[model samples]
Target: MTAVVDSAKRHTLQALLSLPSGIVRRLAGRPVEIEGNILDPEMQLVLTLRKIEGAAIEERPIPGGRRALVDAAKAVGGDLPIGAVTDLDIDGPGGPLRLRFYTPRNLAAVSPALFFIHGGGFIYGDLESHDAMCRFLAERAGVRVVAVNYRLAPESPFPAAVDDVEAAYSFVTANATGLGIDPDRIAVGGDSAGGNLAAVLAQRATRAQVGAPPVFQLLIYPAVDFAVKRPSRTTFATGFFLNKRFTDLTEASYPPAGVDLTDPLLSPIYGDLTGLPPTYVVTAGFDPLRDEGDDYAEKLRQAGVAVQHVREPGLIHSFANMVGVGRSGPEAMGRAAAALRRAVSTP
Candidate 1:
């Protein structure tokens, strides 16, 4: 019976997958020019439309980047749940970092919490880009989620974003009681660059003696290694939402220009994963980051860390963020929520 239900659910989700892409293409046309390794204005416009459409449930302009896209989201997405949204300001190693909290509705006392990081290859994106996904996680998993708005690269380089993530984790663990959360049930999670941060936090938590250890680490299409050559990089480099040139631009924007690409914290697949927390790592079939995510999972398993790796065939790198726009978005959320529940329910 459970298998039947699951199959039906997947079929239903697959049927709805084309809606978001169509919506994005119609709203924003293709790019006219490509400049400085970044997508042309027209392509950026299309990307913005896709982002807004995917995050349409509770769209708002984040701290930086395009504003017109934000306005369009506001007009279409409608009001998100009140209790599910709140702003947070906390002191970090650099200074102050901002966060957005998404609390699940009708949850029990001392619910599990997820420290979520949004994806943008360490360059673009903010809380607004991931609002819908966060809400879906919170409500579906019955977990409180705090999405950190770590400083983007170029403005703040290596270790800066990592520092903010660490600070946010520290603050949350320290104030868990006040926030009505179980410190023991805290998990760290993210996609793309944010996924890299989550992986780093898992290592940091194991090394440092501060606060509760992460109950789980959830990485979705994580950019795990900067050096190791992967087949996906060459095969799926172009036409995908994330391309090699843009990825190079993003990496170049980081501070301490020419930072070793093999650094473990920056590219965690190269890091020691022996003592990291249990992990759930998801990868996309068509994403350039696919091999890295797979390698990270294999490394974790070899290191004896409990790891469950899911490779979503036919999916793209940013599919997790496309729930509002893509037909499979909601289904992806459901899978993630299930994983979070499993991780949280474990000792």
Candidate 2:
């Protein structure tokens, strides 16, 4: 029965995660070793358990696949409880959008805010998937964190996610007074596909010449170039958690056939980076997305944008979501939150 198979799978994963870290490292099998950077032992330990669990980023039947990924993320690195969390719905281009606000226990009269997008290669994640990460950011950074439940791909492909992010940002900025936020101190951020959306939204704001555009962009291993394959795309493709198959599936679902993948709205790395907000980009050394994230940060810097780029030499992609795996993941993410707090706390 389907239920039996699902239950068996759950038990198997639980068993794997319970093994000794050394055994887990051996069980993680082998990846195509790349030159220049070694895998972080801590990350390797967690990833080994994941491999044993057989948690590939493949599409299942609709909601099932989505639920599976969300459960896996929660199982490994469940959220830290926050002081104050609330949910509200806003009008999005597609329909009503859901947003979760994470506020610290000791609330400030007016706080800087980060408009967050949850990453599941544009298909898997939801507000719940990233509940813990958002809470961590709010508590650690001393800022209000709003996580967006934007429409997913295949059904709400291409500009749908972009539209939702823009609408969400606009709503927050417009209602800053009521929301107890400083309009000029808002930033935009996300990881993976959500990071792609954040970059595009910042571009849109810059082009529109909005007076109160995002003051900072927290891009955690952003997928900036969708059309062409960068060197790292091939170098670290498989066994990296975020493999090529997932990337191919996400591309097919969102862009549709014949859509120009090079469009600035879709691939913001190709967009003019001049005059955008101060940007903080985080890249994992072993991720397929490493090179492009680094490239985008350099482009931003060259364009005279204040840029801070951090590279975790031993980690894989999506390390930000693996906070429970090791101290490195949490430490790296906390550094990003600190950077964001500093950027948004100014004028």
Candidate 3:
């Protein structure tokens, strides 16, 4: 029954993707250009489809929100093929941690790996929501991927997610041989809130906290600082998919009431940027969080860290999970995967 459902889902996705670009553009209507940045047409098409569903952030409950996100990811990504997947239980700061390891076909005996974290504003997502992304990166970048199911907020708020990821990093580096990864070549990365955690973990690594530092860091439209309000926040606040209302909900819940937003744990932009590993920072030109991600990349450069920044003007946040749709999202993500492959591969 599960297989049949999965097959049907993939078939639908293929049908959607097989539509001609001319027809997609026709359905998407006029392009959305904000501040000289044009939105990706394929992305616009998805937005058009979403407009029909018309679900508002205020009406979304946590459990339902989580299920919806996972379902949407599966619909688009559909458990893309991979050589191997191994589910492992590791010691976390809070009891046992669940991790899914991905290995691509024809990989080396031991290869570089990515410690991937999923994004959900620190309140929702888990390993299931990002399974397709993990498979995409592992298969495309030719690296092993370990996707962590870290603790979420409102249940284990503030530093709980941080503690678990830090502990997981230590375990991965210590047991590198057993996990079929090269310890020295491990990288850390994530999308959105997960990207925030990755940045925080990299900073801790500089302080000799999370084993050896990650060789590279990939942050996709990461939420770096919650303290300041950039113009983009208001400019693209509504109708761009990730709106201010939803962000407000996440902010209200992730940190305990009366907690400081500027604290480095919640916002890594306020922390010292020295001694960090090489990094690739991605920002969506139409995203509300654009300015902050751009700012973080500049700070990394000034701190003397090797940094690569890409602003996909036509793209929006969550492009990392957009493999099943139009050309632009996959094109943007492919560039990141290429960068990851370079970062992990032996010189």
lDDT of 2: 0.82
lDDT of each prediction vs. the true structure?
0.72, 0.82, 0.85
- Point out the worst 10-residue segment of candidate 3 by lDDT: 50-59
How do these models rank on TM-score, best leading?
Answer: 3, 2, 1
Q: What is the lDDT of candidate 3?
A: 0.85
Better of 1 and 3 by TM-score: 3
Best by lDDT, which number? 3
Which ranges in model 3 have alpha carbons more than 4 Å from their true place?
A: 1-13, 54-58
- The list of candidate 1 runs beyond 4 A from truth reads 1-82
Model 2, range 1-347, lDDT digits (tens) per residue? 65465455445655665577677556655533567777866667566666666546584666777887777766545547678999999988988999889898787888889889988888889987788788888888889998899999888888888888888888888899799888878899999988999899888887774325788999999998888888998988787788888888888888878988899889999998999999999999999989999999999999999999999898888788765444667889999989988998777
Worst 10 residues of 1 by lDDT: 33-42
| TM-score of every prediction relative to native | 0.79, 0.90, 0.95
lDDT of 1: 0.72
Greater-TM-score candidate between 1 and 2 = 2
Model 3, 47: alpha-carbon shift in Å? 0.8
